[model samples]
Target: MNEKEIQTEIESRVQKKLSDLFTTYKTDTDSLQAILKWKPVVLMIGNYSSGKSTFINELLGQDLQRTGQAPTDDSFTIITSDGSGEGLIPGSTLVSDEKLPFTYFKDFGEQFISHFRLKKVDVPFLENMAIIDSPGMLDTVTEKDRGYDYMRVLGEFAKLADLVVLMFDPHKAGTIKETYTAIRDTLPESSGEDRIVFVMSRIDECDSVSDLVRSFGTLCWNLSQMTGRKDIPRIFLTFSEAMAANPESYSEWKEERNQLKQKIQSAPEFRINHILQDIDRQVNEIKLIAEAMNAVARKGRAKLGNTAKFGFAVSLFVFFFLGVILKGMTGFPEQTFLAALLGGTVQMHHFFVPACGVAGTLLVTSLLFTKWTFPRLRQKARNSLGNLITLETDYRKNLWSKVENRVNELLKNMRISEIWFEHQTNLGKIVKFLNKDLQEFYERIRKIK
Candidate 1:
């Protein structure tokens, strides 16, 4: 099947299998909607004069975005093709259109929307995908300077991007404060490491090969410190063909530039994997929650069984012996029922009154357990929800953290009797979807051209 057909099937299957669970757990579906509605997106972010726009322009083979030594643009521009002709779409319109996946940007307010735009071009490269070029990161800028939370906005875009290109130039060597913050704190939480492609752009600007080596070393060191990894990630060394001063000297690096461009062009292919992983992650979260609730249900059943057994035993003893105890204490009864039975003169008719007493006692006990004892058990369970499931792995722990509050809320508000059957069914559905349906989808995607 084609990309659109696969996407449609994914959406249909997710809605069928997990929509109710998402609503119950309060999992946000906006990112899923964004992925479904939009073409594959490549988000570019980097320090000022890091050659992000220059690199994009080179990829498109057009001088679309302004290029300069300093920061030339301070807007978030989405470049795509419209097929009708080249044109521009205002950010206000972009955020308001229901057909587009950008309605969530309305939360960023009008100030950010004013700085956001969509640039339509009649380029073949944009026909299958879209590219988002962000305002360059700066050391001196604060949230107040931008009149918006830039890191938050960037993170949101990162969550939706199929591939993220983090461009760095030799001049900065990956030391810009905002870039450091983004690499350290933002992208890790928003985008997966596999989705990010690190690039050392504008390497031709170095005076010599030794200078380039030194810059590359500095970048590697800074990235190690920022990403907290002992081993270095792959950093593509690239320089724009049109901007190279010593063209022959950097001729060997042209292939690197072309490879980076090819990587960006492969975003559409990556989008399917991203969608599948996203669905898998979300379903796994729900599965963990189901397992937690199942644990709670099991504990509830055990407690109820023990309590009922104890109550029944006490009631049975009272049925046979309560009349004799009352006669001994009050000194007003005739021969007690147990005494008469022991004398071998008791009749079936003589047992009817005590039977009535036992029935009353059992009914009262059940009411007390329902109205008082069960509620206290539920409260205790709710308070110690962390003990419900054993998080054996870091991945399970991560999933638990996402749904911990939801589980807490469920225990607080939902009855234990109501939790067991439904959540068990939900768990089965999630497991089946993940193991069978999702695996089949992956196989189908692998067959795609």
Candidate 2:
């Protein structure tokens, strides 16, 4: 089949699998639907004068973003293709428009809302993906004075972004404090490390190839300290034509720059894998909740079983104590079945007395177990959910933390007595999505070139 047909089939099967989960488990998937509404986004971030805007202008062959050396732009701009060509939208309109995904940016307040905008230019490459050019990362400590958390906002964008381009230059050498904090604390929090692409822009400004090497080494050192990874990640050495060239060694990195651009062009395909991962993570959350409930249920059942046994034993003991009291007080036989042994005579006609006593004990024990003991055990289990977090395995513990609050909400709105679901029922559905639907979709994508 053609690539388009294969992609359509894969998407159809994915949606069907999601629908099946929604039907069986009653999960909320409005968040996932919201994600699919927007185009795959390539987010560009860097310090001031880092040639970010210049590089984007080269990629689309249009000066879509305003570029200057001294922090010329303070707003976050979204550049997308428009068939009509050259349309500028203000932040207020950008968020308020029902078709856009920036509605959540309203929480950043009117100040940030004023700083966000959308630029539409006629470009065919933008048909598959959109680009976000953010205000340059500054190392200043006056963010509270600015009335917004800059890194926090960037972190949110990183979470939704398909490919995040972190542009640096030889001048900064990765010592941008704000950039370090974003990489150290913010980006990792979003769990989008695999989507990050590091680029050292304006290497032409380094004067010589040896100077460029020194700057690159400094960047590697700083990145190692911040990310705490022993292995060094690949960083593209790139310079836009707007900067002066190192005439001798300029051609050395001629291919790396083109490869970086190629990576940007390939973002839409990367978005497919990201979407699948998001769905998988969501479904796995449901599985975690189901698994936790199942574990709690197993423990609850064991408690009920013990309660049943003990209750019956206590009832029999009480009956025996009552017979001893009668025998001591009025010479009534303790063992009605063996009354003749205790006395000197046998009464075969009095079989009803012993039979009735045993039958009554069993009936009372059964009633107490169902009406009092079992319900109380369920209540106790529900109350101690935090303690019941089956962290026996690493995967369960990690997944449990991700879905902990959701599980609490589920158990809160649901009946604890019924939280224990049939394991294979919900689990089998998850397994089907993972092993069958997802695998088939991936195979189809693989076959499509």
Q: Pick the candidate with the highest lDDT.
A: 1
lDDT of each: 0.80, 0.70
Candidate 1 lDDT over residue span 309-328, tens digit each: 97788788887788877778
TM-score of model number 2:
0.76
TM-score per model over all chains = 0.83, 0.76
TM-score of 1: 0.83
Report each candidate's C-alpha RMSD, comma-separated, in the order given.
3.8, 5.0
Quick one: best TM-score, which candidate?
1
User: Which residue pairs in candidate 1 have backbone atoms (N, alpha carbon, C) closer than 3 angstroms, thus clashing?
Assistant: none
